[model samples]
Target: MQSTISYLWHTDDLLGQGATASVYKARNKKSGEVVAVKVFNTASYMRPREVQGPGRQKVLVMEYCSSGSLLSVLESPEHAFGLPEDEFLVVLHCVVAGMNHLRENGIVHRDIKPGNIMRLVGEEGQSIYKLTDFGAARELDDDEKFVSVYGTEEYLHPDMYERAVLRKPQQKAFGVTVDLWSIGVTLYHAATGSLPFIPFGGPRRNKEIMYRITTEKPAGAIAGTQKRENGPLEWSYTLPITCQLSVGLQSQLVPILANILEVEQAKCWGFDQFFAETSDILQRVVVHVFSLSQAVLHHVYIHAHNTIAIFLEAVYEQTSVAPRHQEYLFEGHPCVLEPSLSAQHIAHTTASSPLTLFSMASETPKGLTFRDPALDIPKFVPKVDLQGDYNTAKGMLGAGYQSLRLARTLLDGQELMLRGLHWVVEVLQTTCRRTLEVTRMALLFLSSSLGTDRFSHVAGRPEIKELKEASELRSRLRTLAEVLSRCSQNITETQKSLSGLSSELLKNRDQVHEDRSIRQIQCCLDKMYLIYKQFKKSRIRPGLGYNEEQIHKLDKVNFSHLAKRLLQVFQEERVQNYQAALVMHGQRMRMVHETRNHLRLVGCSVAACNTEAQGAQESLSKILDWLSHQLLQDMTKGVQTSPPPTDPYPNPEPTDLVLHMQELCKEMKVLALDLQDNNHVIERLSRVPTAPDV
Candidate 1:
């Protein structure tokens, strides 16, 4: 009897019993259609196979069939194939149609035997055969091997029985011909009412069946012969339809079957192709379409960002405004105007207010719009006609907004670039450190070896030989190491200098924005006017009397103060120069000491290896000449230029003071002359050190 379980089809009654599994009839709660749900015995049956292997885990779900198993149908006296032509044709067509659907969807009903097929009886009691028992069904391409012989003995393929069930790792290709062969066997069985390759009621007849399928010729040679003769034919003893199909239509089957019965154990066709051929109804539903949408969004962002950057560049150039590193706001500062007397316009006429007050303060307004309390900006500035070119202003503002967006993007890109640079520099530093350590080790080994006294035993005292070789190669190694070290240092210093320069660029930008020199000049002009007004009020004529004398006295006082300030400035400048000189002197001394030490080491090393007297003498002479010209000349010149101290220690003659004065005067005169000549010499020097083209 059929039973209901929520919305699913189920059975209250058991349909069949087996050693491994049990089948029951079920009814759909909504449609009341019958279905068979098979419950597998967990201990007896192996698990559902994985793509890699098999275990006992799979259960079958089926549909109820009133006509029972194909085996039972053939065994009954009335239904057994003493073969009525129409009945045979109908059964063959039903089997072929179901198999075709499975194959097209890339599913393999690997076990296609009589016991597995069931015939559904309609309300009118007419039987419609359908393939069921999907428990043994597997994806055709699954690599996992199911070890057990799964179906009735007669339908097993010869190759499947003989060969390993699991495909080898190297086998990438498979076709649907294996399933077709099983269908052929099923067709032959239905017509003959006997298992094709095996007989029943024999002693363990499965082994004989396996042998026939594997090695012996199939009993139905006539079937094969008839199929070859007909071009393409079905196995039905009575069928009007032809079995021939186009190659393209046939090619579509493998992937189709692979989809539905997709034994996940195998390489199954993806859902994309499965749904496409499921039916015309399901073809409209698309899966996994978001990938295309994301690509489109990515493209739009890049294009919009680029357009914004170009617009910003154009605006910055046309307006003669340097691109601001920080955000810009036009509404932060507002303009004010200086008061004008005898003005017909701009003055507010109030009967209660004094005309003189209006005349006095008419030059500037007390307040205006768009002022920040944090910043001290001028009350007045020259204003532009912002609304005059509304269209142009609109265009420029649009461009400016674009620039702001692009600037943000650039900031992010710059951060990434800086991070990349940091990583690269870190790697370079690591490499340099390793190289230095290796060179140090090599040098230590060389030094120890070259100190050897051995003469003939080179191989036994290889360390000594190595040392001698190292001594010979020391100059080349030192030169190469120094060159590389200098290059690395230069790269580091260049990066540091670039960082400093970038900071300077920002500083310059701030300075340009904050410049109020023009406003300061106007303030000064106003102050001068105030002084003039005071002078006029006092009736102080500059050309006559006490007023002129007082003014002249004030002017002299200002001049004396200015001169004193100038002297103070000069004193400060001299102090700074002295400190700078001391720094330079100390640096130079250290450099000289290091150079001398390096030279002494090299000289002693060469002397130790001086087997040739003439070569040693020539090297010494060249070294002496280089030291004399380059080092001594610069040192002596620096010493000569330094002045004597001002502190007096001994009772000296006034003549000493006189001589000191004379020396100072003479040196000043020579300094002036040198200064006159230095410009031309510097120009010549600049032109002389031209880099050679590579």
Candidate 2:
């Protein structure tokens, strides 16, 4: 006779059986539909509303997950070695999410192997792996422990295996970390498609030997017997080469596995820490492909916290080229990239541009390129105009906050500003020092370029090269002068607005609950405005003024046409000095331009952040408008300058250039010292009060 339980269904076929339940294929008599019925040996399974059973037994009905288990996924030919990094991370995220849910409810899942984890394909076609088969699960606390062993043999904790399988009568209690151990094993299997520990013959036969190998080694050590029964243990820290994990990912994964697959439970990371680490990796890890001369270096993993210098050093280890020799060319443009920028930031800013190897080795000695201004330039400065720093700030502020959240958000923004300022100050100090160095180098070369007698033999004709060169230098100096002066004026305006607002808050500091927060924000604004103070430092260039004397001299030079036959006097040696001077001039120009860029970013960051509140939009609009107008004027002035000279021998009169650079050097020294000494910005930011709980 076919096995039939209740009259409501027919159980003509048996599906599967487990430790506690037997699944049977059944047909609903009323609906004439087929389904699977789970008949548990116990009286109940959790709490079922409409219970169906023979006598006191519980017959639970659940929708089958037709997609099957993670074990099946591992069994596929594509996943024969293991799931790919992307797929593995997906599985990890889903499993951890499920584990977190279980943890929140104070339940421990004793069985956490791949077989118990089921894959569900949602209607959107996204794969979601969920924890199933909760038969071995029990209510457990962090501090609570159970002595009963209730998991698969291979995945079970050693202590539980000793007590349950070996029947050793060992006095040990299994804590919630038992599940963590099982998880470690399961994840490794999902990643590498194999168990972590093994003996010479098999797990079932050499259980004791496998347990010895697991516990005897130090933390993170992988050991197993290879050939002989009593052979020495083979220890290795890396995954098998046949495994599909990239070297970069393996580096990150091995450590995590070592931590969680620890023999001692105290050494194991709890689910919370594990989730945090994995999520952090998901957030910061980026894989890049680096190629040089047809040789591809694949899977270059860079983190957000790493600087370009550090990344280059890592690349050097892989490739023989040192950091100094590595020149990155992206989209055919030689990258004038900063070593201090975050590797991820560099990657982000570069977009999909393929970077090539360097040809230029060695550098212009360190002190040549003086500090360009604006160190605390916001991180969100976009490559394109569409999603610039302001837009980024607006996006961040769009997530409206209230009460404690509001206070916290404000505090965080202030802190971010502070950190940026602190880093900027350090950068400024270096920039100032380098500026001084470049000034000296220019002065040194200027005398040589001016004293050269190579042109003495040539007939004096209306020198178009001299005129063009002098005009270009004058234009650069004029732009620098304008940037500094306008930056000061703009800062003055922002300060005026901020000072008024800060003063108003100060008057009611005692009555306000956010007194400290207000003070902190005030300090941040003060710190930002403090950058403007550098401009006021004694301008050794006499008003560091319009430098009109040089511009007037440049205008006087006649470059309209040659008066006589031009002489091709090959004075390459003499012109080399002029070239040196030219390089220094270019460096100095870039420094001044950098300041403008940084200032622009800072202004945009502040304007966007403050405009989130009421009553400041008009003031900010005026400030930004003034800035936009001034910057536009500066841009137009640049456009008016002649393009680069075609001849390399084009020379400018060095007297005016020498004086300007000398004065610049003196001013830079003073500015560098002043910036180096000013600890108030950091101190003030550090003093910003902590956020309130309420």
Candidate 3:
């Protein structure tokens, strides 16, 4: 290793070696510019004095073509099939330019093969293939001929192969057209990754057979034939699916291949023609090719005036996937191709990224997709106006659920409230009515005791209302009725504040009812229960000695008012929550109505695309069906218009075919038609020609 002059060089870092010179990678010390040096084999020592004596100059740092030689690239697993149309163009441009320069200076490259070609990365990141290893090249005119044969056996022309390999005694001079054959073979290997002609045995061992295969073929027929070890000859014209060339590029390339792959000297295209064709393709057309799977690939051509519709049509033609079946995506979101958008604009916008394709049947296509960020399916995005509704729906549903649940709990307690009210009414009726009956009996007894048959109680039945005690009872009844009437108010005692209010109720215990202890309330209830236990004992006890204390306790608690208050509490607790649930339910219902309206926009988008695709399918089907029907009608007319066979075999059905010639009793009739009619007959009959059923 040595760092000398203006560059650092390493002896072991050999780039490549040939019969004349060996190339090495080097770097300039001042500028740190990397370059490939082509040093003559004998001139191993560096001499920076002269350019011809071979001290090559480095202008700018060039990125080494990590792809190595064309041969190594073809041998790679990815290029096992070969270079696609785009990369193939790079090779064509470089070789044709190099060849043109060499030929213009009266030099011929006798050896033009994959190994002799080298590549470098251009400033634009495009591959720049260069024709290198010019050891076998020499100065020669177009008409001048050379006696010695050179080049790889597989890529060599038949004349050279026969003279060199077969050791033929005859001498033949090869002209400059020999290089054209080698270039043809090289281009074939570049595009397809294999030789154009092959046999069961190797090229050198099967010398005579290789010669016959090459020479016997017609001019410009570039189909490749390969003889397998145990199988028959396999000839193929279509390039492999792995070749990532666009449809436009492949179409342009086939003709170039045909013109150059010819054996006849007069038929091949010159370097001038090759350069123009490759240059036109590289500058004019912009085609993008995509691979979907191991087997499926598509090439979509883009142009200035083309629309999205035009672009999809090209995709459909190449991939056989219908537009409806294909789902394009951009930046990880579904890409809805806009019908009116310019395809060229989209292609340019997405030129830096790879595009991915998905089948309608796939859950979602993955990996990559090329799509413009601005492109979308119209109205597919969520509407901002409706977002509020969507966001609020869940809260409404939850609130409604809680409200209804609370209403159910209150309802479950309703049965208990009704039962308590019925008991309170029974207690009130039994005690009050019995008190009046006993007082009437006492009044009658007093009236009989007196001599004058007069009673101390002087008031009549209607006038009993005038008594102070009666008035008092009437006032209590009126208060209970008024309180019961106000059902909406929360009249029940507040359990939380009852402790503070209990002292007040105790101070005026006769007037105000407090929630007494269970023992106190139970004593009153038990006294009433005892009366009902015995049939005779169940009679009303009222007045002075009729269990007065028990009755007074029941009276003070105001059972009737408590029952009404309890019912009011139950109704009040449920009504608020139940009504709230309804309101929330109403909110959700309105949301559904609004959502349905938004869904119509989505449905319209779907329907339009579906209808368009269906219309196209229906149009094609209708045309095919119409054509079939027309042919059938024409055939039916022809069968009817033809003259009847005289030898019908059965002298009956005149239009029938006569198959039994021996049974025919008369001669057959023949019809002569005009030239135009004959052509029409041929056309009409061709549609229904007799064919074997598979």
Task: Output the number of the lDDT-best candidate.
Answer: 2
Model 3 clash pairs?
85-245, 355-369, 355-370, 356-368, 356-369
Question: Which tens-of-lDDT digit does each residue in 282-344 have in candidate 3?
Answer: 555454433222112244545557787877776677655666655453332335566678775
The sequence of per-residue lDDT tens digits that candidate 1 reaches over residues 1-694 is 4323432433447677665677876666776766677766754435334321244443455656766787776654323222333354456556766876676666667668767778777788666788876665666542333343444444555445443332223333334444545555665556544443432233144354334333434322212112222132222222111112212222233234323322222333443343345332211111110001000000000112233344223323322222231111111111121223112221232211101110101111111111111121111112212222222222222222222222222232222222222222232233334333333433333233223322212223343344354233434434433543444354344445435534543553354345343233333333433433433333433243566546634533443343233323322432233234334323332332333233233323322222222232233233323323443455546544334356464334333433433443343334334333433333332222110010
**Which model is ahead, 1 or 2, in terms of TM-score?**
2
After TM-score superposition, the amount by which residue 588's alpha carbon in candidate 1 deviates from its true location, in angstroms, is: 99
On lDDT, the stronger of 1 and 3 is 3
Q: What is candidate 1's TM-score against the reference?
A: 0.28
TM-score of each: 0.28, 0.46, 0.40
Query: For each candidate, C-alpha RMSD in Å?
Result: 40.2, 31.2, 45.1
The order by descending lDDT is 2, 3, 1
For residues 283-347, what per-residue lDDT tens digits would candidate 2 score against the true structure? 65544433332123235556778888877776665444667656554343445446898776564
Count: clashes, candidate 3: 5
Q: What TM-score number comes out for model 3? A: 0.40
Clashes of each: 32, 3, 5
lDDT of 1 at 375: 27
